[model samples]
Target: MDSGEKRLNELGYKQELRREMTLFKTFAISFSTMTLFTGIIPLYGSSLLYAGPASLVWGWVVVSFFTWFVGLAMAEICSSFPTTGSLYFWAAHLASPKWGPFASWCCAWLETIGLIAGMGTQAYAGSQTLQSIILLCTGTNKDGGYFAPKWLFLCMYIGLTIIWAVLNTFALEVIAFIDIISMWWQVAGGLVIIIMLPLVALTTQSASYVFTHFEMSPKATGISSKPYAVILSFLVSQYSLYGYDSAAHLTEETKGADKAGPIAILSSINLGSFFQHSETSYDFSYLYDTSNETAGAFVPAQILYDAFHGRYHNSTGAIILLFVIWGSFFFGGLSVTTSAARVVYALSRDKGIPFSSIWRQLHPKHKVPSNAVWLCAAICIILGLPILKVNVVFTAITSICTIGWVGGYAVPIFARMVMAEQKFNAGPFYLGKASRPICLIAFLWICYTCSVFLLPTFYPISWDNFNYAPVALGVGLGLIMLWWLLDARKWFTGPVRNIDNENGKV
Candidate 1:
């Protein structure tokens, strides 16, 4: 066995996954999963409505820096414990022994729910983008035109979710290669939009308009002033910057995981932040000159169509750009499925989920978590069903995802800072003296953002406009606690290491 496999054995687990993913492929999965198009395009209007271009541009910078620190904290722990059950495993081992099981249970469920919600939201957005493309091709705008029914959109969402499940059930090498291609697609696709949009625009706004212009909606239900609005605008960046933990989830299949895993986690955030910053800046620059009604209506799509209509001679160029974003969302769904399935499989292996034996089974021939893949897909479909009743359900799912993921991230970092510091051993990718301050800052930032996500996105508090994140999170946590109190605590210890290597010196 190679050194990585030997290390896994020493850590009390056999190499059940196919360790064929190279460092680049590992990074690719994380990068592709955290696609900017999926987050930025759909939510662009909300950010603009609250804080306008200034916040969208500068807020992302601040959020990215803070997010990088969170990644650093995560990567340090990942280097020491490179496993598929990354967050939960870290929480369990890092917390006090008396509280480790509960901590692990909470972290596991939060990560699982967050990932499932994430998958649902991405697929839902992809479906909407697909519909938009169809509408655009048929010459149908928001005016009296041939708009598709809600059922059709639901069908498209389910179809996309199925596609993700099928792709993940394939050989691990196939998924790895797809991730590599996804990385290129994200970079090249983003560059095309960044360069082409400006070239095609009849007129571009000045730097001052892009950088210094501060506008807010009079009807905004949330924060009103530009200063507070800017802080709230950080939500867009936080949502997009997530899923970088996909690197840690795929650790079992990654070569040189201790170092490679940490690098992938940090690099994904840095690279995604750069691309997102560039794209948002350019889009907002042109959008500043467009009609407020149009900018507020469809955000990125309308902005692109208006800017490039003169150059393309029609809406054809704009449709092509939408297609690029749709493709990125599709790829992102695939990566999300892969990550969520691995987490489910890991959780089940330790008897954390209800049908542990079934969910934990890896396909003997392909070495993929086939059962968990389907389970993840099914849950995503159910989670997305509410979108049929209320389109804003997508927004609610987005909030739940942000809260769950940020909470999952925070638990381990809190433990590392408060409980594990004295006994913590530095891994190959240690942060040295800077670790404590970084963890503290990351923990605080997570708390702040999580609070932001819970607030209603729109004012007046109508049922349709209300954010259901708290409801979803509460129900999920309630069920987990019920299960724990009823039976889990009696039998469940934290992670059940498969092997018993005395002193880990095998």
Candidate 2:
């Protein structure tokens, strides 16, 4: 057996996932999961409505820096204990023995829930982008003929989710290659739009308009003050920066995971931030000149339509850009499904979840977590059903994902920095003396962002417009606590070692 396989055995788990992914492929999976077009394009209009250009541009920079620190901290932990369980494994290993079980249980559920919401949000965006592309091609406005209905969009979302689930059931090498292709597609496709949009436009916004311009729409007027508007606008960038932990979750399937895992996590964030800054800045500039009352509702789509109106035949250029983005979103959902199912499989293997035997099953031929993949897909579809009735469901899902993901990230970093600092054995990718302070900063940043996510997205919040992130998160946590009290605490430990003498190794 190889060293990586030996390490897995020493940790009391057999090597189950196919370890065929090289460093580049590992990084590609995480980068694809953090797809720039999928996150930024869908939410561009909302940011414009709140904080305008200044916040949209600068908030991205600020969030990227803090997000890098968070990724760095997680990368450090991942180097020491590379496992599919990721944050939950880090929490259990880094915390005191007495508190380990509770921490792992909470972290596992938070990460799983966050991943489900993240997957749903990506598919949801792709569905909307597809609908928008159809509208643009048909030359149909809201008042025009043949506009698609919300039910159709919901069907699209569900169909997309199922497609991702099916795609992920393939062999590991196939998915890895798909992710590598997705990485280049995002890089090349993003550069094309960022450069072409400005060059094609007849009139471009000046640097002042792009950097200093600020406006608050009437929809945001009564509900949000200027300062709060800026804070809320950060969501556009913050949401884009998450899901980088897909790297850590795939560690079991990655070669040289102790080193490659950390590199994948940090590199994904850095590369994603680079492309996001370029694409979003240009996108914001384009919005500055073209944003009318109607355009404000779908900023990116309208910007494309306006910029290439007369340049290309039949608005083909705009449709192409939309299709590129739609394809990126589809690939992103596939990567997320892969990551989420691994988390489900890991948790189930530890018997931390109900029906553990079922979810823990690996496909005999493909060597993938087939059942877990479908379960995650089903949950994503159900979570997204609200979009058929309320458009604000997107915002709620975004907030839920942000809060749940950051919460999962924070617990392990907290344990590493404050709970078990001396216990941590730094791997080859160790941060040395800087680990504690960096983790502390990352934890604090997570706390601040989690608070931001809980705030109301709009004012005069009624049942119809209320952000259900808190409610959904609350119910999830309540169930976890109830499960702990009733049953889990009796038999569930942090992790169950399958190999003999495993307890002695720790």
TM-score of each: 0.94, 0.94
Which regions of candidate 2 are displaced past 4 Å? 38-45, 142-145, 218-224, 276-297, 310-313, 501-506
Report the C-alpha lDDT of model 2 over 1-506, residue by residue, as the tens digit.
65555666766776778887888999999999997784445363266667677777788889999998899899888888888888998899898998999899889888998898889888878887788787776763633524468898889999999999999898988888999999999999988987888787767777787688787764543444888889877888888898889988888888888888999999998887886432323344335332331233356677677667745535678889989988899889989999999999999999888899999999999999999999999999999888877767887887887788778999999999876456777776788789889998999999999888888877677777677888888987898889899998899897888666535443
lDDT of each: 0.80, 0.81
| True-vs-predicted CA distance for residue 418, candidate 2, Å | 1.2
TM-score of 1: 0.94
In candidate 2 the C-alpha lDDT for residue 92 amounts to: 91
Worst 10 residues of 2 by lDDT: 288-297
Q: Which ten residues in a row have the lowest lDDT in candidate 1?
A: 288-297
Report lDDT (Cα) of residue 175, candidate 1: 86
lDDT of 1 by residue, 1-506 (tens): 65556666766787788888888999999998998675445363266667666667777778888998899999999988888889998899898999989889889998998898889878977876777677667764544434457888889999999999998888978888998888898888888887887777877766677688787774544555655677667678878888999999988898899889999999998888886543333444334332332323245566567766666657788888888888888888899899999999999989999889999998888989999999999999998788678847777888888888778998999989886566875668898788889999999999988888887666667887777889888888998899999999998888988876775532
**Model 1: per-residue Cα lDDT at residue 205:** 68
